[model samples]
Structures are given as C-alpha cells and as structure tokens.
Target: MVGVPVVLGVRRSAPVPVPGAPDAGAALVDGYGRVHRDLRISLTDRCSLRCTYCMPEQGNEWLARSSILTTDEIVRVAEVAAAAGITTFRLTGGEPLLRADIADVVSRLARITGPGGPVQVAMTTNGIRLPDLLPGLIAAGLARLNISIDTLDRDRFHRLTRRDRLDEVRAGIAAAAASGLRPLKLNAVAMRGINDDELCDLVDYAVTHDAELRFIEQMPLDAGHTWDRDAMVTREEILATLAGRWDLTPVPGRHGAPAERFLLDGGPATVGVIASVTAPFCGDCDRLRLTADGQLRNCLFSTSEYDLLPTLRGTDSRTVDAVLRACVRGKLPGHAINDPSFLQPARGMNAIGG
Candidate 1:
C-alpha cells in the first residue's frame, strides 16, 4: 500500500469451498500432508547478469509486459494466499531488483497476515543492485535475503556469471550485513571442476562477512537443459571438502527447510548444503512458486503450472482462492529428477523464478 496505486483497507475474505476445496480453516495441504505456507514470487524474468548455469549469454526472450502481473494483481493474490494460510513469502526473479517498483511490492505484501500472523517476507537475488535497493527494501519490511555468489574469485566470477561485477556484489553483501540483517545467507551452486575446490575458502569468506554460506547442488534447471547428474557436486563431497579444514557437526533438525546445516569447528560460524539433486527433501517441501507471468507452481521442477492471472483479473476472490487451493492439492510427491521418465522443464531457471 505504501507505493502501490490501489487503495488500502481491503478486508480478508472467507474461503469459498468449491468442490475438492480444502475445508474452511484448512491450510494448503497436499496428498503427502505437506502444508504449503511459503510462496516464492518472481517479480520479473529479465536479469542483469546471465549466469551460464541459469541462462544463455544472450537472446533470451522475456515475458510480454501485458502478460506479467501488475502491482495490484500481485497484492490481490497475496491477500488470497494469506487467507489460505500462506505465512511466508519470498520474492525471487531472474533478478528481482530489475523491477523499479520492487520496494512498493515488498511494502504492500508485508502488510498481509495469515493464520501464523504478520507474514514474513524474504528474497533471493544476484545482489548486483542490492546496495542501491537495500535501504528502501529494509524500510519496506523485507525480512531476509539470499544472495547468489557462486565464486569469490574475480575471473571465476566473470566466467560463471558473464559479468565482471563481483566487487558490486561483495559491496552489496557488506551493506546488507551492516544494516543488521544478520545470519545472512549466501547461495553458491556447487559445480564439479568449477567451484568445488573452493568449499573451505567460501566458508572462510562467510565467516569473514558474518554470513552463512549455503552450497547448492546444481539441478537440471539450466536454459540448455544439458545438466548431467554425474557432473554435479554432491552433499557428501561438499561436506568432505569442508571436513579437510573444519570439524563439522550437523546442526540438528531441519523443519521443512531444503538446506542441511552444520556448525563450523563445532561453534558459531556455520555452513549449509542444499542437496536437491542427490538427497531430495521433497517430502518436507512446503514451498510453492508464483512466476512473474502469474502462474502457480507446486514444485520447482513441476511439469505443469496452474495459471492464476485469468482468475485474478476476470473472477472474484473466491475463484482466485479456489485456484490457489487447487494448485496445492495437485502438487506432486516430489520433483522426480532421478526417475528415468523425468523431463526437464520447458523453461529455464531465469524464466522459472529460481
């Protein structure tokens, strides 16, 4: 409401129980009994940097402006989602900072409340423009942030992202920490023969920056769709690499979180590994995705997407809630990336809202 054109004061409407809809007070539950509370919203598919693992260096087609969701439409869907028990919202994108109205979007959604109370808002970004946007975003109620920093080396950073902006990214990270966003997390995709050897160095860097480093296994979400399972760095290998330098103690229970965390040297500093490829956490997955084009995805690797734009624009709140509920009910048990019949999604990570 702070930066949006629409008027505030819209009341939270009650759920209209259509056939197959969840009971009035039920959260977004799937057949596997996973209650969906986290929603990842992609503000845009256009990015400033073209990471080799995400998209091509050039010639990537973006969504048409008319097809993308407006600020009003996004807030409306968030309201419906809040009513349906979504408690946490994460804004993602090819680069979420690419949108000029990002702070407005954050300010508006931060006001939405679900069963769990004031909804928590987070974001995943490449951090190129975070320094410029951090002040407004923090003032607008951005709860946390996850920045992608695959490699700390200047040349390797350039090779991985097709950009020589590592200094900008590092400055952004420092700025965020100085602003009191503590326990800040930095995401690094572990690619074999790429950044695998720098595991310990990355952790050291995190320690120096007062940030927690998370190493994610590269899944088949690339534009080329040529992901080879054999080439991806695994959780075991990552831990093993770190074991050479520090005594890692697995930091107990994971409550539906994708990352497996560990305390470095059995003390304060920590590191995490998101083994999405080798050790799948689909059973505990409570997240859903909303693309910039207004499509709802039950899973990151889901082959099917439920469109919410038409219902959002042409129908009432009840219909939009019904669509949201239906999408959750239709979630697959897992991504099934290891299955022989698995097929890569038609869109790349940039389009899919990583």
Candidate 2:
C-alpha cells in the first residue's frame, strides 16, 4: 500500500484524536451551512506602515518577541485547523513579510490538506520588501500571493507609508508575477481623498502586468476609530466610476471570496471590489483568524479573543484538539454587518490580522 507523500514540515504522526472527536464534516459547517473555505493566520502583530486606518495613532504596545508563536508551534496549530476543515490558509500580519522566518511558516502550512483534502497556502503582503523574499517564498510551497499596493504615485506612496519604496514594491510585484504566482492579487484600500485619483492607474497597472487587482473598503478594525463614513469610496461609486471606462461582465455566482469579483473588457487583468463597508458580507463569513500571538478571533471586528497558544502549549495535543474544536463550535454565525452601534475596537487592523 502507498502512503501519502510526506510534506517536509508536517508531523510524521497524525495529531492524536480524542475519543469523541467530532466528525470531520462538523468541522467544515458554516453558520449558513456553507463549508468553511478560508483560514487567515496573523504571523505577526507588528508592521512598518503607519497606514492611517490600520495603526491610526502614535504610540502602541506590540507583542513581545517571546510571546509570538514559534514556527513549529504555528505548524501544529495549522495541522489542527486543517484537520478540522479549513482548506485555504493565508498568512497575514502587521506585515507577514516582516517576520524573518515567514518562508518557514509557509513551507510548513503548504503540507496540510483541507476538507476536500488538498489545501491552498497563500500570503498577503504590503510589498514593501517583497523583492528580497518573493522567489524563496515561491520555492517554499506558497500557492498564491496578494500584495497590497494602495497607490501608484511615488509622492502619494511616500505620504501613505511615510517612506519611499514604490519602486521596490513595483519591482517585487513584477518578480512575483513572473515567478508564476497564480492569482497574483493586488489589494488597494479606498480612502475618500487619499490616493483615490490613482484607482484607474492601479487597476490598469495590474491589467498590464497580467495580475488581478482588488479594491477593499476601508473598514472599522483596530485602527478604525479614525474611520468616518463620509471618507468612504463605496462599492457603488467605485463600480460606477470604473464602469464608465470599461464595459464589465460580473463574475457569476457567489464564489465565496470576500470580494465581489469582475472581469473588465479591453483590460489586461480582472478587478474585484470588496465592499465590506457599504455592503458587508458578514452573514457568509466562514473564516476564523489566529493572531500572531496565538489568539483565535471569531470575527475580524471582534475585540475579544481566546488564547490558543497557552492552551495548546501547556496541554496535551488531544486536549488541545478539544479546545480547538470548542473554538470552532463557538464560532459566531456571522459578523455584525448591519449593526451600526458598534464601538471602536481596542486592537488595530494590524493587530487583528487584516
């Protein structure tokens, strides 16, 4: 009999299951009964960007180096999450690329299987330093890449990041695309006056390079207290503006990604809009997040979290599995998309794994 090909970083032995381990099917169930398809891991709670919405203020306390999960610890958690039913795992961070050993983490997660049993391992980066890491990351079993390039103007890029690396970021993106990273997603945050003028160019750049571009609504997350509805570039407005230029054909059906995807005519690449602010898709949110410090967040907007690292580290693997199972069972049906009376979270977007 043939055995499954061993992935380099996975445990040679399977996680010890408890006597009453729930059927793997139960692990995949979503609030709407849609199978959970995505899992995002916050590799770190620190970032170099002072992007107004993500880290709005001056001084902040970050996780100590010791508190952050080690690569091995993270791999174990990935195994548990994968065993439970999450098929897609994407590494996020204050900037996941900031972590020195991010490629190691990627190498490990690429070994796991989802409910259907083979998973897609990906990462979201700010692209500030992708040039140094892109090629090695691809070699480490990374299946896809999403690089956040909020603006194209060099001066505007400096204003947004308080630094200058537009040239490096652009180079990194090109290298990643050339390296055959499928669905090379370019993410931009739409702020009312900040960099909105460059939306067309941002989208056009992606098209010219054979990459996919997505514009995400600025949301109320950790750095959300600085949020103002008046400053929003709603999906309707973005679509209306983009539609005037190109005749678009909507990608049919709910493809389950957070963004409402589309393909543009006379364009080299596709564009997608994530309307989390104007038209939130909370009811269909079937993902769970693990912060850099090992806390599992049920909702992206949630301020409360359960510490999975301590529980997983101090307890036996079987007991840890039970705790993980409880975390999933306790998953909220969906985030509060329609609720207006929400308070600004104490944690910032960088802290929340956005």
Candidate 3:
C-alpha cells in the first residue's frame, strides 16, 4: 500500500486445490516436467531510461495507472503462488525502483513462506536509483541485486541509454556493494560491434567492485523489433573474448540458472553468459513471469498471457491459484527463438518485465 494506488477491494477466497493431484503442492510443473519455483513479477511498465535495446526513444505508451496491480493485489497473488510451491520471487520492471513503495512490496513478499521455507526475494534493477533506495530495499528483505551496466564509457552509456546517468549508476553500484548486497550481479547485453569491445573492461569493473558479471545475448525483445541475429554477440564469441584474457573453466551446478558461470583462474572473480538465443536452456528453466498489469507469462517470449487482475479482484484466492496453475500448464517447451516460426511478442522488454 505504500506506493501502489488504491483501486478495487479484493475478495478473499479459500485455498484452492492444487491441480495434477499426483504432483500436488509440489513445484508448478509444466507438461515437459520442468518444475517452476521462480517467479518474476513486474512492478511497472514505466522506466526512467530509454535504452535503445529495451525501448524506443519516443512514442511509448504506458499501461493505464488504474490497470497496474495495487500492493495488496500483488501480495494476494504472491500468497497464492507461494502456497503453490513458488520459492523464489524476483521483482523486475521497466525499472523496479520506480515504484514508490517498492520497499513495502518487498517486505510484504518476504513474508511468503513456501513448502521449501521462506521465499528468496531478488530484484533486477537499472541501478541508477540504488544510491537512494538500496538501504530501504535491503531493510525490506530484498535478498539479491542484479544491476544492468552495458558499458563503462560515459559517452557510449549516454548513446545507449539516451541518458547521462552512468555516473549515478556507478555510484549506485558502489552503494549497493557498501550496503552488503552480497554476490552482486551485473548484467550486460552483448551486442556485436557495440559494447563487445568493452567485455574485458566490464569484467574488470565487476571484479574491482566484487560483483559477478554476466553477458546476456541480445534477444529479439527490442521495442523497435530491429534485432538482427547477424549482429548478435553469441555465447561462443563472449567466452572466446574472455578466454583470450583469462583462463576460464565452467563451474558446476548450473541446472536452474540462466547463466552458465565460469571461474577465472587464479582469482575469485567469475563470469556468466546467458546464451538464450544460441544455447537455449529452456529445458532447465524454472521461472515464470507476471507482467505489471497482472498478466501471467510462462516464458519471456510467450505470445500470450493470462490476465489475473480481474480474477484477483472479483474472485477468491482459489480461483486465482487455478488460473496460475493453468498458465503453467500451458508453458512452452522452449522460447523457440531458433525456430523459423518464432515471432517476437508485441510487448517490448520493458513491458515484458525483463
């Protein structure tokens, strides 16, 4: 209730019986036997920066304020999801820190105890606002941080985001570290001929700051839909580039993680690569997504979403749980980005909660 606007009153419902009696109360398993325990909830579709790879520089339409989920509504859905076996909750957004009551939201969500134990709460932030918000967020039970840093060069940062906030972002990263946000992760979208030349520099930045770095392959989620496969920096290329500077070895136990982590010999530093386009780890994916407007997405590239706002507002928790389960039941085996039939979702990365 801190930052979210009050809308309709919620009607409480009894606990809904879990679907698939055989796997009842277990992880939300899809038809392909992938048990989902991680949930990414979008806080809002609005952002402060207009990164070219994420959104267009102009003519953007945000979701109606009334349509976005209220704090209580998000908590209700999270309760149902927690009961249904979700144990990891990640808050995302065009920029999650944009929410005025994000700290309050984190506090509410931290109370959800699933079968495994207390749910782990994490966030993927742009980091420009961390200097101001990190303390409250940590106090509110935010367990981890994933900061986005595409480049360290001030001019290139300006060109990429159309914003001159790189210095603020760096300050935020330092603030996050000083605040004891352990295992801090920096995510950089790898694009051919763009920041590809700065891979080493980015790694050095991460190492200097005691943060883990990951390079994610450019996906087709740009607002312009101008993603060119030929212009993408592949996982192989990233690894080779890093290998040239340091001896890299794969780390084990990467089953459910999107990033394939590798250790740099003779140092505590490590790097990860998320080859979503080239490697496709859909088989090991254990994540689900909920858009800001209460639409449930089984995959990042899902063409369709299940609206849960109406149900959350009008019905009981049981019905809401049923809808959540049904959405998981419809999860695709893979994003199918490599398939010739793949089509980009209408919503851009910001709208989709990446």
Model 2, which residues run further than 4 Å from truth?
Answer: 1-25, 30-32, 222-224, 266-268, 315-318
Q: Could you tell me which residue pairs clash in candidate 2?
A: 222-347, 222-348, 222-349
Give the per-residue Cα lDDT of candidate 1 at 194. Answer: 84
Count clashing pairs, candidate 1.
Answer: 0
Tens digit of per-residue lDDT, candidate 2, span 54-171 = 7754677888888898888888877877877778888998999999998888888887775567778888988777777888888888898898889888888888877677888889
Q: In model 1, which regions exceed 4 Å deviation?
A: 1-21, 315-318
* lDDT (C-alpha, whole model) for all candidates: 0.85, 0.75, 0.87
How many residue pairs clash per model? 0, 3, 0
Off by over 4 Å in 3: 1-24, 315-318
lDDT of 3: 0.87
* Arranged by lDDT, best first: 3, 1, 2
> What is candidate 1's lDDT per residue for 192-278, written digit by digit as tens?
988888888888887888889999999899999888888988888998899989999988888788899999898799899998777
**Against the correct fold, how does model 3 do in TM-score?**
0.92
| lDDT of each residue in 202-319, candidate 3, tens digit only | 9999988899999999999998999999999999999999999999988989878999999998567899999888887777778999999999999899899998987978854547
